[model samples]
Target: MDGSSTTTALVKAARAGDGDAMDRLYRRFAPVVHGILLSRVQAADADDLTQDVFETALQRLHELREDAAFPGWISRIARRAALDAWRRRAPFTGEIPEAASPADSVESHRDAEQALAAIRSLPEAYRETLVLRLVEGLTGPEIAERTGLTPGSVRVNLHRGMAQLRERLGLREHER
Candidate 1:
């Protein structure tokens, strides 16, 4: 079966209380959820918020109207959860705390942080699409499928978002 069919089946099974199916659905969609949260929330909070999104989705599974809509449904939940978290947090003070892992060099961590900050400064649509594509490694078609956006819209968003991102990062087209 195709991926969408499999996702539909998994959603159906999950709604029926099948633990394995729920786990499979989580595995399949967590990156999308995380990427969504990452685009709206601080990096440190995104992981926790991803778990909250899945938990909320699991609890509300019965309310989901269509099995095949799970991707879009869960994404909306992620976005809402992120917005709620953003609302609850204190205002940004132009300083993001350093969160360097032992394996990451300071320079790499700083670069990644700067790029993420630039992304967050973008408009909401571009931020989410860019995070899903660039950070989560989802392709345009996958993003379109998961987010229920038209393929053409996803393409346009990616193209325009990348251009804006390049400008923000001070990189010429040839540099990329």
Candidate 2:
């Protein structure tokens, strides 16, 4: 069977209280959930929230109506988990807290986190696509399969997002 068929079978077994099936599903999708959470929250929180997302998905598996929708379903749960974490960390006063950090200003960590910050500064469409591809190590087709975006859209987002990053980092037009 193909990946989606295998995923659907696993989801079915998981829904029927198959612990091994759930484990398999978790093993398959953990990085996806982690990537989604990491895109929204800090790394430490992302790890914890990744567990939270899986636990929540397992507990609520019976509520999922279609196994084929598993990717989008779990992705939504991951997004919600990140949002919940964000909400818990904030005061309830209906105000948005700033997302900037002192670390972003230092620029000392020029390897990984700095690039992440530059990617984060892009518009949401670009930031999300870039994060899934770059940080999560998902290929363009994998990103589209998981996120329910058309393959073309994912390609466009990655291309446009990279261009913006090049401009921000002072790369010459020819360098691209």
TM-score of 1: 0.91
Residues 1-28 of candidate 2 have per-residue lDDT tens digits of 8778888999999888899999999888
Q: Write down the lDDT of every candidate, Cα atoms only.
A: 0.87, 0.80
Question: Which window of ten consecutive residues has the lowest lDDT sum in model 1?
Answer: 91-100
Clashing pairs in 2: none
Please give the lDDT score for candidate 1: 0.87
Where does candidate 2 have its weakest 10-residue lDDT segment? 91-100
Clashing pairs in 1: none
True-vs-predicted CA distance for residue 86, candidate 1, Å: 1.0
Using all chains and alpha carbons, the TM-scores for the candidates as numbered come to 0.91, 0.82
Writing each residue's lDDT as its tens digit, candidate 1 over 1-176 gives: 97789899999999889999999989888989999998888777888999999999999999999998888899999999988988999744434466436577788777887888889888888988999999999999888877778889999998889889999999986887
| CA RMSD of each candidate after superposition | 1.7, 5.2
